[model samples]
Target chain A: DVKVTQSSRYLVKRTGEKVFLECVQDMDHENMFWYRQDPGLGLRLIYFSYDVKMKEKGDIPEGYSVSREKKERFSLILESASTNQTSMYLCASSSPPWTSGGNEQFFGPGTRLTVL
Target chain B: SQQGEEDPQALSIQEGENATMNCSYKTSINNLQWYRQNSGRGLVHLILIRSNEREKHSGRLRVTLDTSKKSSSLLITASRAADTASYFCATMTSGSARQLTFGSGTQLTVLP
Candidate 1:
């Protein structure tokens, strides 16, 4: 099975503090994504990367950024954490690009972030 | 916006009984996937049905998609206590957005 690992499962940070959520996948997947899941809203894509150093904005990209320094690793950075940012963050990795096939994302266990 | 909307946000069923849930989405899609997530855990892919296909089955789960109505239904036969969890339908849109548009989800509780 696919193993997508997240840096932390539960996190707490003061408002205005910087936050980082890391994800790594063993399967050499080309597509990686970061999403925030909330009640009623479901899972909203924050950022997605097709290749190292390549990223694209999703439906809700404001106040969030991502980095893919390596093919297996993706990072989500919160410049300044806010109370509104407190939610469940999910990381996912997929096989390859769209032209090749519809990439099916395999997700990591989400990190519950709480910004007080 | 979420492409899919699950009917009956919550469902309760007796053990050994069947549970049926519906999902409706706007716009065309290449495929629709069902996922099961236990409390506080990552989602596990249950099944995927394509637009051309009307129905698909895996083990005890059956999924059907109706393009004309832009809706889908999932049926879990002989549901067990272990089957208690949340189910979500995700629509795989056409294009570079391989991203799936997920529904709000339906929470199921199976009573033993």
Candidate 2:
């Protein structure tokens, strides 16, 4: 079984603060992703990393940045957290779609961030 | 947007009853996947049906895909209270990007 773990399950931060959310996967997957879930928007991809040091912006990546210094770890960074940034953040990892034969993403439990 | 849209945003049913949810997408897709999420948690992969396939089943879950209609349906038979969760349908398009587009989701509640 694949396991994806996040650094925090819940977090609270003041406005304009810099926040970091960490994720680690044990499956040695090459693809990792960060997403934010809001009430009506569902899950919107923030950023995805295909390899170490290689990152691509998803549909909504303006307010967030990501780091993939190692294969097992991916981190989401908020440059300046705002109240609007409060959301349930999810991290997922999977083998490269072409090689995996199936594009099934395994996700962590998620971190509910509250920016006050 | 290649995002799939789930119909009947919310569903409520009694235990031992059947529950069905439908999803419709806008573009051509290589595969469509279903996921289930409990409250305050990340989603878990449920089933994946490719465009070339018509129907697939896992345990009590049955998934059907119709490329012509650009839609898919998930049926859960003899649902239990533990089946209550938000279900989402995600699409992986035929392009090279390999990004999965997700729908808003359908909240299913099974009463005991």
Candidate 3:
């Protein structure tokens, strides 16, 4: 089965601290995405990468950034962690936007980030 | 309030009964996809229906797409307690093949 893996399942950071969440996929899919899930807000995209060394901002990318140094890995960075940023971070991957048959996304277990 | 909007933000149903969730999008889409997420976890894709398709089914899950109404629905028949989770509908907008905009999802509970 295809799998997406996140580096940390849980993290706690102090305010103004820089935090990084890493995601890796084993399927060689070219699309990677980072999202934050809140109780009522649902899943809000923070960033997404279509290919290595290329990234795009999503709906809520104000305080977030992403990096893709390799096809199998995508990283999400928080320049400065804040309490408001405390939420569950999810990483997902999909076919490079060109393939057919099950182009659906595959997700990681998720990282629960706590900003104090 | 996003492109894809799911109705009845929360639902509670008994096992063996069917559970249905509805989603509406604001723009034209190439496909509509549904996902399931357990509490405090990541999402797992359930199904995807292309714009040209009207209905599709997998196991106990049935999805229907209506391009004209810009809406779709997911029906889970003979639900089980294990089916309790949050259901999200994502819209793949026409011309945007890279990013799929997601909406607030519906929290489903199948009580045994």
Q: Which stretches of candidate 1 lie over 4 Å from their true place?
A: A97-102
Question: Lowest summed lDDT over 10 consecutive residues: which window, candidate 1 chain B?
Answer: B92-101
Residue B32, model 3: lDDT of: 92
The worst-scoring run of ten residues by lDDT in candidate 2 chain A lies at A93-102
Q: Provide per-model DockQ scores.
A: 0.59, 0.74, 0.72
Best by TM-score: 2
Candidate 1 lDDT score at position B84: 96
Which whole-number lDDT from 0 to 100 does residue B67 have in model 1? 95
RMSD of every candidate to native, in Å, equals 1.5, 1.1, 1.1
Clashing pairs in 2: none
Query: Looking at every candidate separately, what fraction of the true A–B Cα contacts under 8 Å does it contain?
Result: 0.44, 0.67, 0.72
TM per prediction: 0.96, 0.97, 0.97
Candidate 1, A87: how far from true, in Å?
A: 0.2
TM-score of 1: 0.96
- Model 3 chain A: weakest 10-residue lDDT segment is A96-105
Per-candidate Cα lDDT values, in order, are 0.90, 0.94, 0.91
Tens-place lDDT per residue, model 1, A16-45, is 999999999998888888989998777888
- Using TM-score as the measure, name the better of candidate 1 and candidate 3: 3
Worst lDDT run of 10 residues, candidate 1 chain A, spans A96-105
iRMSD (Å), candidate 2:
1.3
